[model samples]
Target: MKPPLDLDQLQTFITIADTGSFTRAAEEVHRTQSAVSMQMRRLEERIGKPLFEKEGRSNRLTEEGERLLSYARRLLYLNRETLAAFDDQRLEGTIRIGTPDDYADRFLPEIMARFSRSNPRVELTVVCEPTPGLVDQIKRGQLDIALVTHNDARGQSEVVRREPLLWVGSVNHATHEQEVLPMAFGRPTCVWRRAACDVLDGMNREYRILFTSFSATVITAAVLSGLAISVLPECALRPGMRVLGEADGFGPLPDCRIGLMRGQTDQPEIVDALARHIAESLDNISVPALDDATGLGFGAQALGRGRRGTATILPGW
Candidate 1:
């Protein structure tokens, strides 16, 4: 049988030992110094030994207290691990998803592959569209979820990730100011194109639209040939591209939102599993700063092949 534990006493003991001062321990645990002193006294009594010895204004753990410190950390760590284990098993549902073309190219493939391995039964239907198109599809209930670039997600979907949009051009191109730049993007329904235009408009900058295509490949190809510059997500800066400048301080663009849209009733078990897997997978990815490039060859080789009708796995879907 396990011995009875006074958790409060044990916690107080650990806190005081860690901080090496009653006053500091009290501050850390958000308790009054007098209360902390009383808790420590009670802990000593329960253990039937002196846990600390006072020297001047500070405290030091006695030999017994030192021994107990190891046990305390193990206990707290085990408690958290146990809680996480239970939660990990509780999530299960099919999450039909739509997202922007760039997101599919940059980050979704690895995430999807990992998700498939972890939750094989989850039927994931991922549609690659421009950000605005994805948002529209979700609103119309054609998609159960969408990952879009909308700031605030106000009156819309849930924002999952926020990062700055940046200016990118082909390495071969000499970048001009916004006024003289030739631009490439998806069709008019693209939020990134809108954001870029909005910025240029506000700055009273004149620019020309060189190409429009839903395919990231087309836009990238055009940009690579020095036909245009584009405002793109930081992650989209591959080796062939160069950052001309930081984003022209547009109002916060919509974050990459992974919204749990209403009215999805596929295989509940499968949907839930996929959603959980996605959430977990995304959490593990570290979004790097715009200054340091994540490099190309991630999807460029396969994507650059110019072959259509190939089966591909997208991320947010």
Candidate 2:
């Protein structure tokens, strides 16, 4: 039988895949860039396949690398679970995590469930708020960690996931055809709201903010009620929503980036464990394909799964 894969090398590989840079992964894993490169080379040799390829200034995983990623995550998770099972002193503390309401709706359930399973002794305190407030809580040391929309101007964060920001309207509504487009949007501080306004201004499109709210529920209600249009990321797409493209006179928007912000805390190990769970959970999320008929990217059937009462809206903009 072949030699077992090295867990240390596998961890470094996963970090590089998540961060999209060997250099950054080095920083995360507390190794030099050259050391990280050496570990990856050994990993590739053991697998007998090139794991990464140069893409612009960063590294993109090769097909083999993509295939190995799933196995790597599962192996590491199993290792953690096994260790926790027998360790009487397994981490036990309260972790205060903040996320915007939209993110809480789409992502928190899976994250919380997985983290709780692995670290059952730990208590989780979840706070749902907008990104700005979450950031403030992080700065004030009130929150141990936060999942927020990554904005360089706001502060630094570890970017975890990204998806296309699309214009969406009710499938049954002709809101896009209106001369003065009515739109529902988040507060002015929201990056998505600013992006939508800027894009419309550049296109000289006549539009009015029909509804304004910090709550994703309010904005989603406006869109699904056939009263307004809005911009949202891929994961946020829901059954009644139709994505608007260039054919609909809507310009393309920037990608929505989700990130993690950690505050100064005494419980470093607990915080790191939670962070890993969040990253893994978000990384496993599959982006659905765009539908040709209604432009509802995951289709109505896919959106119908386990999404009974959830509102389709942008997360933590």
Candidate 3:
């Protein structure tokens, strides 16, 4: 009988599937692209089938690969469960995680779930606040760690993800075509709000803030209801909303960076483990920040030439 398929190899396969790029998979697995290719070759030899085939610009999975995917995911889940079941450490601690609601909805599920499953005794406390607020909480030692967005390029931040801030409007309404663009944004201190207004002001664009709320959902509702167009991360663009572009004549929305910030308190081993899980959960994300070619493809003309759809696989980021 052939040797059993390796769990790590299966994970690599899943990462490639999740990321849709070998380079990204390599980054996820902390290996070289050549190493991933070699693993694929080994996996193919064991199964007597080719798993991947080259497609236009991307290496798409072959039919055989697709068939293997469902099995691989099941096997990996079982493997993790088995390990967790056997782990004797039985870690117990409290983890106070802070994140903006936008990110809380997009990114924390897998990290929290896995951490909870492995360390059943660990109590988790999640606080949903704006990025600036989260950072403040961390600074005050009120939060164990926080995921936040800022223009901080110094040693103070470890970038976990980058996303484009696009001009978003409702699909049925052409709210962006008005003489003076009406905007719905978060609080004045919001990084995206600051970036959007600065860019519009610098370009001398006529605009007004029709609504302001700290809640992204509310801002999204405003856009979806045709109340006003707003600046939002690509991840925040729901189905009913359309992305505005240079062709639309609106000023550019600057990209945002999400970073992992440590608190002032000393981190315990459990906290370190949780941090590792957070990093691993967000690995290999392909966030093309505002590249017209394959980025959001917001423009009509840009959408015509192959659509480079946004990656929602990073889950909640």
Candidate 4:
């Protein structure tokens, strides 16, 4: 029989995959670069397949590596759960988690449900704010973990989910047909707002911001009321919204990236558990599909091109 895979080696492999560099993974895992390389070599030998291949200046996971990653994450997660189950003392504490209001409605329910079931004794304090506010809270160590819309200029974060950013308008309103396109958007600092304005400027399209708010509810209200159009990620889509694409004269925007930020905390174990649950929940989220009756051929095509090819769009505002 083939020998069992080493848990430590699997962990190192996952670290490399996450960090996208042996050097960075070495620092994260507290091992020398050469030692990290040796572990990967043995891991590859055990699997009898090359897990990674050189791509330009970086390493890209091979097909086999991609196949192993899912198994690796599951194995490590189960290992952690098994160890935690036997501990004499049950985990108990309050963990403060922050997320932008845009993601709160869609993401929090699943995450809260899963984490609470596993760690019933743990108390959760959820703070809903914009990404910038969440980042500030993390910096102040007021939060244990934060889910933010990843923006490189803002700071570094571990990105967990990515989806196409789309232009959306009310299905009942001909908002996009307006000569000077009325719009709803987030505050000036929002990355989606910046991307939308930049794209519109590049296209020489005239537009005016009719409404502005950090709350998704406000933006969705504007769109649903047929007051304006807006930009949004796939996961935030709501009913009565129709996606506007190149056919509608709006240019494509960059993909939206969701990231996690960790703050200084005394309860590392609880934080880690919550972080893992957050990542897993985000991964399992399926985007809702657009209604075919909306006659948004372009938007429907765009949705089909996403990672899961299933979901609607809500304005990022």
Candidate 5:
């Protein structure tokens, strides 16, 4: 019989794969980076296959790595389910979560503020990253839950909020209907890039990648500086930023979903309560009524509908 795999190693491998950095994985798992590396090496040896290809600071899972993903997920899920089934203690433990800097900047603080107030006993850790990183982190059990930009359907997550991605630029930028449009984008792996590129490809629109970075702030800065125009969630647009009238050749991008995800669906009370609270708050948020009198650009529409304190975001803007 094959020697049973160690749960610790499985979890370490998953975390490293999900975070894409040994340093980040070690912090998530509360282990040293060297220790995490050692565990992964042992895991690869035991399985007799290389799980990940190390290139620079980033790591991509090999085919063997992908094959082991489901097993790791199942193992982690079963372990959490079993623990939650038998434990009868009051809800207490740190639940680390990942969120995008854009969402964290504009939306999450208010919701998390409320969550902290209600559950004084539960510790919540929020890691800010781009959407793809957030999704991978959740899948690997690095994050208990995440608020992220929705992309391709991920079997491991549940959508709690869905919102449109909008096109924005500086007011001074020129519009071009005939030439390749310039764009400022997040990293290559970002959902926004995929969404933007897919639409551009479908419409056969010519375009050029003007600028790209992992930092939302950098992208926003580039757009704000008139370096290049960009498409982003409407909520991210700010004063001095201009909303380019929708890309003329493309249909609306799908609403991006953001919500809770864990290796195990069965969650402890604290985690479940936090998820419910976030979902309910998201649903209940009310946008302030728009001013019919003002004929502002597409950017202003978002703020007009956003109530200072309300829930249930409507489509449009």
Candidate 6:
């Protein structure tokens, strides 16, 4: 009989694969960088196969590693599920969560409702704020978990969903066609603001920040009312908003990852449970929305494409 794979080691392995680096995986799993490396070495020795290979600076999984991924995932899930099922006590605690109104408006309430049903005793406090401000609150330990669009990859932050950034405008307005584009954007610290400006600058297109607000509704209303247009994730594309691409003389924008970050001081068990729920919920959202939504796409059906010329877009800029 084969010796069973170490469940703890497998957990670390999965985290490394998810985050793309040992340093990041360690941060997510609350382990040291050296410790994660040691676990990987031991795991490789036990399996009698090398699991990773260096492709430049980043570590790419080898054939053996690739094969183990599905099995590892299943084992980890079963182990956790089995353990939780056997536990007699119900989970209960107060979890403070922060997110931008954009996400809060669409997804947060539903997530909160479901989580409450599962964890009846666990109180949840939800806060709405811009991504930049939420990160600051997390760092200060004022918030337990934050749903954010991060410019920099840090922590064991789980990326819940990936969507393209789009230039959205009112159906009634020709805001995107202006010589100096009038736009609504989040404050300076918002990653969307940086991404939108960067893309426009690369195209040498002049733009004016006509309306600036953190509220997604305000921003959406501004665009819908023909006050100004703004850049938004495809998933958040409100109904009746016209997508502006090359046809509208606007450049393509970089994609954004919706990430979940837990506070350093949050109760591990509570945060872990809630995080798992959030991940599952977000995963469920990607498929149908991609297929059913007319303008937004999951790579195949693009919401925005330029007919005249391709705008120079720097990925991850």
Worst 10 residues of 5 by lDDT: 308-317
Q: Which stretches of candidate 6 lie over 4 Å from their true place?
A: 1-86, 153-156, 287-300, 303-317
Give per-residue CA lDDT, model 6, range 98-139, as digits (tens): 987667766665577556656677888888877767888998
Model 4 lowest lDDT segment of ten:
308-317
What lDDT does model 2 reach?
0.85
Per-model TM-score, in order, reads 0.55, 0.85, 0.68, 0.79, 0.60, 0.66
* Model 2 misplaced stretches (Cα beyond 4 Å): 1-4, 18-42, 45-48, 55-58, 288-294, 298-312
Clashing pairs in 6: 28-156, 93-122, 246-306
lDDT of 3 by residue, 1-317 (tens): 75799888899998998688999999999999999999989888987999999888788889999789768866776676578678887667788999877777777876787777777888989999877677778778899888777557322767766666677777778888888988988887777777888988998889999988886667877888888977766555555777787888876665656688888655477777687667656552223545444224463233322212243311122
lDDT at position 42, candidate 4: 99
Give the count of colliding residue pairs in each prediction: 11, 0, 3, 6, 13, 3
> Which stretches in model 4 have alpha-carbon errors above 4 Å?
1-6, 26-50, 152-156, 171-173, 286-317
Error of 1 at 230 (Å): 0.5
| Worst window of 10 by summed lDDT in candidate 1 | 306-315
**Top candidate when judged by TM-score against the true structure:** 2
Among all candidates shown, the one with the greatest lDDT: 2
Candidate 3: where are CA atoms >4 Å away? 1-81, 153-155, 283-317
Model 2 residue 300 CA deviation (Å) reads 12
- Which candidate order results from sorting by lDDT in descending order? 2, 4, 3, 6, 5, 1
C-alpha RMSD by candidate, in order: 12.5, 4.3, 7.1, 3.7, 15.8, 7.4
Across residues 1-317, which tens digit of lDDT does each residue of candidate 1 receive?
A: 74765667677777787578888889888899999888888777877888899888889989898777656655654454355455656334456777666666655775687665555545678898766566667667787665565533423654444444555666655655445778887677556677778877877677889888777677777767778877655445556666553343323333223343332555556555455444444444443222234223322332222111122212121
Candidate 1 residue 289 Cα shift, in angstroms, is 9.6
lDDT of 5 by residue, 153-263 (tens): 644467666555656666655543437878877777766677877887887888899887776667767776777767765445455566554544544665545656654
Model 6 weakest 10-residue run by lDDT: 306-315
